[model samples]
Target: MVSLVASSFMQVACAADSEGTSPNNQDKPASSWDDISDKLKVATTKGLSKLSWGLEWLGYKSGFGEQCTFVEHPSLAVRKHLQANLKAQDRAVDVLVASIEAWERTHAKDHAPLVLALTGPTGTGKTESSNLLAEALFKWTKRLDHSDKDSPSGLLVFRGEDFSDNYTNPVSQYQEQIKSRLAEHLFRCSGKALVVFDEVQKVIPHTLDVLTSAMSSNAHLTYHRGGVERRIDTADVVFLLISDIGVAKMEQLLIQYDDRRHVPATQLENDVKRALDAQWTRLQFGKMVRQVVPFLPFEPQHIVLVIQAKLDQLSEYYQGVYWKSLAFDPALAPHLSTLESMLYIERRAVVRGVDVRKVFAKYGARNVETGPLQQLKSKLMRYARPWNPEAQFTVRLMPDERTIEIVACVEARANDQDKANEDGGGGAIDTLSCVSRWQGEFT
Candidate 1:
């Protein structure tokens, strides 16, 4: 293992040196031996850190000692991400920050894990918020680190439907399985795991009792099987429970306030907790939850921003793939307005003399990506060609509102223009022609 780590360190050092100096700088003076040695030392340190992390993950001790710890304070990163990407979720973001800060302060003491319940309507950023938290906590790279069936990347997900009682299997069986799985994973992770339980309302009471017990324990999670007792420390673990339990009441509150910004966050959270408590009277885990965060519905303007952001991302991707400049027509605002109408539904409630109104997505942002944006990607792929890699291509919506046209701006050179004039044709300096047309329904 030492030799393998050393070899990796050397490779990383060489790669870093090569990437630092481009081909254009080849004629410059070579770096001194001292500089190269410093780079090697830096690469070796990084390599050892990664190696230590791997060893620790596999339940092995590393020679590096405490330097191998991977958990980080994610307050700043998470706050910035939520502020920039998530809209109309100030209360949720605040609760998450407070929970993390509190955990940081008391993690050394033996205590139960922090349990947060995220309750809201569908497509209200519940999943996105959890993913962000995971990324920040573990410093995870989406492309490099991923969760699979065989192994978890510090983030474990469990669906409520998977634990439901069936004819062949009973709820008690699922409870035991979950307990075992949690114990093993928590042990391997050294209690630094972020476990997400989605659709919590669908989870049977029997299974929920098991989960509640795990969170309500002190310092360690104990499991006994085959007359053998195993205890795993869980002081750093966090449980994120996602549900749509009080969506109706939340919408009603939004309506009462006339604006989501005016809704009292404390009142909203208390109301949701009461609703959850009423529904799950058997376990009553609602009262035990550390915090209850609410995700409000999205307005029309927020939906427009989301759609535009998706298009912007697609444009950046195609620019690299097609090696051409991709541009959107400025006249797309009308089309975006039409799309916003199709994406969300409006609800109204009358309280006193005020008419409360709220808007939310019919199908969440995930559907938007899989539905219209996916089709848009396919159309771009079918039409985009690298014939003139330096030319600019404009994407436009047709009058029918269902078709898209890719128009290429082809500039006529002086020689081409002269030839055209000699051949008895109009000599145009700049020519715009429709290269490809894609006709499809949105959604």
Candidate 2:
């Protein structure tokens, strides 16, 4: 910011002095007022832009990128986010932050991407925590769009299971495909890039073997095509590998130590690392990890917190962007119920792994793609089971299913006064009770 301010001032000063006549000159040419005026306009615009940016940096303005960075230590910000959004990973948070910081510093000179492996249980925030690191560096995490065939440059996402199924694709061909696809993105990006590999456990050893070459001293993958070596640069990149490889086992380990309360991070890290290492070894994926951040299973309470965070987020979003006249109950219709009951419902939903934001989107009350809530909405969608918006649904229970469907989407008839009157002023159910997590799978 200091350099930016100084640069702006210099440009202004240079522009002002470019056509000025000397005061002592005997004969002087007429100065073009238009040119001077244009310079002033440009200078003012640039100055104001810089000034606004400075204000944002100084906390006087709310700008997109400003609030996401580290004030001094990025780890502090990362910790703050995790402590607030996640639970029972205080030690993991420190290790993760320290790992990333250490890797970045060393990798700048080493000329290879720093690779991190995040292993954890299903609902734990391993991926979300990685994203916190992403936001710290890039001001915002650039999400890879699956819908678009053309991925946005610099950020590429690979899902492990996509290349799985040996019957469908031969291992040799799959390996080549993985290498070539990754190489394509790596070469296209200028300078450093961030590539995230999610569900790493599902990826076959042959496909992940591409990493051995990518993480080499030269930091480039070599592929022989037509008897010529073609190289793709990956030296100046960051690779985050997220997996549930030992997740179930890790969860079991943590549960064994649940009552200990003061279990050391080093011990937890070691145990989880062993579990993940066993998986990696069993899968025959050779060692390539510089750091391993093990995300433990969140206590059921933590899921409640994450769900509550989502609720608070929605409240803020609606406050900021709610259309004044558009009122027909919030996406959470039973908000009119007692606050205690409403909270109970929300918490129960969280325990059930029901993402309320997706529920909102399901009812058409929320347009998830067009607001600040998109990130939260996206995360919620991941846990959401598919539901048809147009089809009429029933509330009856099926004995064949293990998971209970809590279908509560009721369109308001307030807009249609006739229907409202017929139903005795909108017959909305307000009863909310907690249900235990289903022990088995349900469709």
Candidate 3:
């Protein structure tokens, strides 16, 4: 490959020299060989970079490609998604959108990546908000499209636990590994990237030194590999550092304000920043963070909305799989009641001035989805059969409250004996019978 490239460069240089010198005889000075060589070098670099980008777009893994560009203004789309999907995170959504808009407008003049520190309790829509931002910025149709072979989406995710302190390996080794991985992705994507570090509190502060340096203004990531040094620009990149640090403070602020929307953004951010600074006192990378966005704990109302959304999603999925329409009886009121009972062992917790929000905060929206919603989906898959396309199934909480029952509604005529046993004395009506019932423990 080296010889071939060299020969190609020589041929192009020779062709350019011939053309430049042959310029219709008189008035023009002869072109210098050095000038021809320089032009050829620029052309070769551009051609190779284009080729690498093209190959990557076609689903081939090119080691290095053109930098990924962002949408001109992704804040609108991001705001829309956050408002429509994420529940009870108005403050987070506002700060995130504003920060992104500002970055988009001034990124060319900025020296480093826009670093956002997302601090909150678990399952408070921190990760979900990150995903929404990635989708909007990259123009992805779905969250999973980031991994699609045809799409050259510039989103990279890292877990802090993966770089945590270990007895066997030195912290410096972990730092080097992170630097190498980040450099490779940044070079491949051409510095147009969104890098996310989830659970950053779990990582050793020393392990993130590379990130701190790369995120510094006027600093570029220098990757040394195969005897070549590649400088990856961080100006166009965005970094999201998600952690649960200072969640207690955030929760307290929320309680004090009675609502997250009422909490002063400046104060909330300062508290989170202080907590982060205290935790990472040795490294003090917290100073590099541009915005400290707080994802407040989920309230009961938010949890209910989350539960309803999950049910709707699950119902849509089951409908397609079963070839039958599924409906929830009286919506999500019963489900919420069941959830509260399962979450709180003692009813006095609510009576003793402990609001249900505490329970909602403890589990968060993610737990509700993964726990009760997952079990509900599993039960439907196991018991709900697609026997009749015309039949509709209703999911309702049984009288016992702990048991969930699936009832099938079939349209048929009832005789005298059947009427006596079934719904009163109806001649022709829909008869409902229990299809399946099971007691689910929401944990």
Candidate 4:
């Protein structure tokens, strides 16, 4: 564990060293190491200066804590995200937003935090909704940290899967990390920060015990930093545990209901409460949490909305890309949307059990692939490929062999249309696809 921490720092040192280089900047005057280091320090902080060093060892740009003067208020896009993506979760969203806003308004000198537990089955927007909330309050999703599943930030994340095996790394090491981070963030934020333990069910009881002091209202946490046990205050920090423990069975239990869209919030909350009871009791941290908000299994209508929302995200993303009218072929969107909806649910209450982001991520060239996926990946335009600067894109998935075809249509540019036509491959559907049976959908 210590070695892991050291390696993380080493990576940061490597990044700092590389910042001084440039292939073409050799002609430019080079700044002294001190000047460069100061500039790098300024750049390393991505707006949030108060809590910058919490993740300094990791070399990622840092975020400001809650109490930091530079933190941003929620954006319109974040509000729109909540309004568009989350359905039938009005209760949860309302409570969360209300509480956080209230916390922000309070003038109390002492610390008091709002703790929430977001529980639900897969693909029901629990995480997305949380992101929406975070974005609204924090200005950007990246500042929330661990938003990418594995990151360091004021919004600390504990993956339950990793914590389940304490034998591999001493739990005390993790405890130390969590304790120090929480203390730093809370102090920076004036006793307020969001800490998430995702996939909470996978964490062992003893490991969770580490969080008790941090969760308690007293905000007292005890851990050894330098062979000395130290205490810190966490009273202003909000703790959110995202759990999927009883969600599968809960879906099964709700299958007989006819009006799936209107599952009572109280009823869903109760279900989450029941599932969390056994573990909370075993872990002895049941009373610390303020509320259990259930993310119900996505219904067909929910899936439909989610798919459209996801597609819009894709469209909005590539819309700004250099030279292309990027869009899901209107003809093909319906088919892909249908497939996305089918993937979210299960036998009783299921939807795409997987995140749709992974699909959108396939377009990036950085990731490695194998077999036909690799072949399909190879079809993409390289970083510097030049077929036609004024080309448009339409994404299409052929029915068989799980083929995804990127259809690029070169458009007539006033200056180059004649040249384009003369060169051939002109004004036609240029197909980029691979041959393969992509069986990535849920069985």
Candidate 5:
């Protein structure tokens, strides 16, 4: 395990060093596709590392390759698409958009067209990848260190709001205007282009048909307006159709087919995942299967992974330093969990309007002095057991994970003993004392 971790660290270090190209320096054309692929692999690996870092912080090992995975397009397919659309007129604009420029140069222009779609459920990051690809192509080559899945980048996205025209009538009027405006923007930006249609299913069929020609035939979609017809050039654009309806439908089907009542954790996670997969199986859009990316719903485990990953990064950056001197304080664990639960669940049950202010101020320690940190301390105190009416339970962080486990058992027994002793006179043997007398018990 030590050797594996050491090797992983070394790879991360090496990737970081290579990522830092001087800002003034421009990316020179790579001699071969292999070189680009190798470089891209490093970037891809680094991107995954950040994702894993977030996962580990949530309290679990990264399952990126094992379960949480993204789809990848082959260099050959990408190159073929690029070469076919990249002509002399598009050379300047297309170069900036595509990373696999070398392979693209080899393929002939004006051949069979290429159209790629990125379809998935809501929040699975279909539109997000489009933005990331755009940013990687046009702005910085490296992915951002701190980026959310929903973070947008270089792609030009058109939402349903953009097509705010009468759907009852032919969409030619407003759809043409939208296409014309969008085409002008892409044409002006001399580089590779990406067009994302979020919730494409909501779009009118005629509008979708217009897009089909531009995507499949590599032919420009003409929009007639004001005595002239304008063409939206899509030869160099990667078209993406993102949707959630398919996944929603699949979820409904699963709810019916599988028993929804009293489902086990394993079954719940699997059913949700199966529902997402079914979405792809029932895909209806024309030739959408060729470009489909079935996004799975995030399971609790996934969120746990992200949190654990974040913790790992924090641990590394801090040189394994605990957040504070008391971060690991054993007293803090149970209290922390309790505090979190109190804050998260049944907010009304834990803290509310009047209780909120009282929580910030120590119950009896202070006479309502308003100090933020102290108040925070008071609120967290709610998690601790109220023993010895006058004594405040000292919240401590344990350095060892084992210490936490052992202390928890001790605390449980102590609470029971304290309750039992409460009936007895003030001077009495505590639970810890009784526990210490046990011959076989290990501390």
Candidate 6:
């Protein structure tokens, strides 16, 4: 009797276990995020997952075959914000990206309701981050692998040029375009978009006024064509407006004087308020800040970080074998060094381009044939190794003459091939000879 009862208990236990393990169990799969705000909070508080980015980049290149450039620092920050929609465990936020995340966390909703107004100096990556976020949004929806070479079909990028043609009739022209784009944006992916407006200050007031109403009132813009007018809703949109308006004011103060010197917070607030009330006359910002969103001005460190980050990104992009064959030419090494230095100086120059070569020529770069430059190029090319067609490389430089100023005469190239010196061996020739090939993209 006892053995029979124990056998029956085992069978009941097995039945219970089977029921729990069944596919129709009570717990559903963890996928769709009922509240995207929570996911954003995780992103803002914990920064982005680098592993995810690596995977995405791999997929983008290998799966999609589309060309994508990654910018570090601000670019990384932008990438995080763009991909913030994805949720996972073990998220970690970096100190460098705290402000942006904090701002996002402070304002979250079912849709991307935050309209981040990032204001900073020229190199601060405000524009970069905004662009990345928009791009990521497009990529996310297309579900195309990063490694796939095929380009996504639905991409609507709005640049200042798009609105430039209608500058004279600002409101009317802009209204038409804005309405159309908005319609398209909603028709396909209603609440799942990343819209960015760079240099918001450049936007005309009347046009800005429309954007302001659309954002604040969450109203759809209406347009009339052939005596027909239509209105749409815009409650689930993520709008990003970037500007350099406060940059000049911020940089001059920060660089000239360590921002340790503080104006009373109240005083700054009052000044901002005064500026806000005077918006109608100023007409530059269209009362956007005073009316629409917060204006966050980046500090000096932010500028330095952005510039350094851009350089690092460029270096990484150029590190591969793209230019291996050219870089390895025994005859081209010295020219590459000169080119690199020239680019650095050119960046510092007031005006850039071929004039940079003239500067080098004026410095008595010799330009005589078979001169020190030839030797240097040969030696460097040898060091670079043989040309590898499969190698990827990047070249970018500014045409600045000063690049050659510090070089010893032994390294200078000649101005002419056959021409000799005025006094024979003194080595005189054309001032502009031994031209080096230019490589890399110039901004």
Q: Model 2, poorest ten-residue lDDT window?
A: 357-366
Q: Can you write out model 1's per-residue Cα lDDT over 1-443, one digit (the tens) per residue?
A: 46667887678667657755766545553554455667778877877887766766554333232211334555666677676666557778888888877767776664778888898878778988887777666643223346432222467788988876545557688888888888766765666788898988877666666666567756467798578997777766789989888887887777776467788878888888888788667535675588888877766565566667777766676664464677876645336535533566788887897676677777656555765667667776776654466556777877876666767665554436676869888654555444554445444
TM-score against native, each model: 0.72, 0.55, 0.71, 0.59, 0.39, 0.44
Displacement of the residue 317 alpha carbon in candidate 6, Å: 3.9
Please name the candidate that would achieve the greatest lDDT relative to the true structure.
3
Query: Which pairs clash in model 3?
Result: 67-189, 67-190
Q: In terms of TM-score, how similar is model 5 to the real structure?
A: 0.39
- Please tell me which predicted candidate would have the highest TM-score against the true structure: 1
268-350: candidate 4 lDDT, tens digit per residue: 66776887887788766778887776666555444334444555555565453633565554444334434422333244333
RMSD of 4: 14.5
Error of 5 at 434 (Å): 34
Write candidate 2's Cα lDDT for 1-443 as tens digits: 55665776677667556556545332443444565667767766777788776765565223233333323454566556666655446666777778767765676587776778887656456766665555544433233556533222345667878866756646777778777777666554443566788887877656677667686567888776677888777776668888876654554444444342566667766777788778778555537777787765554344334444555555444432331111122322222121121222111123235332111011111121222234334433443224323222222223643222333232433255566689888544333322221222221
* Candidate 1 backbone collisions, by pair: none
Instruction: Give me the runs in candidate 1 sitting further than 4 Å from their true place.
Output: 1-69, 84-88, 140-152, 166-169, 224-227, 323-325, 329-334, 340-343, 354-357, 386-392, 397-404, 409-443
TM-score of 4: 0.59
lDDT of 6 by residue, 1-443 (tens): 33444554455556545555667643532322322334444443333354456556666556453333323333355446644421110011222144335434543453224444554434334554554455543453344466654332233345554554443656776866776776666555543445667665565556655565456534454545457775655544556655545533332332322242353334433444444435434444434332222232333232223233333443344444423222222222233333322222111122234221111111111221134334434433543344433343322223552222111111234554244444454454323222233333211
lDDT of 5 by residue, 1-443 (tens): 33444565567556544544534222543333345467666755666776655554332223222221111332444344333432211221232234334324532565222444444344444554555444433421223358634322235667855553444655776556666766554544321355677776565545555455666554466655577876655555556666654444323333332232333435433444454345434333465322334443332223233223333333344331321111223333233222222222111112223222111111111111222223333433443333222221222334542222111113222244554577664443334321111111111
The weakest ten consecutive residues by lDDT in model 3 span: 342-351
Segments of candidate 3 deviating more than 4 angstroms: 1-69, 140-152, 166-169, 330-334, 337-360, 387-391, 398-403, 409-443
Question: Model 6 — which ten-residue stretch has the worst lDDT?
Answer: 86-95
Clashes of 3: 2
lDDT of each: 0.69, 0.54, 0.71, 0.54, 0.40, 0.41
Alpha carbon lDDT at 359, candidate 3: 36
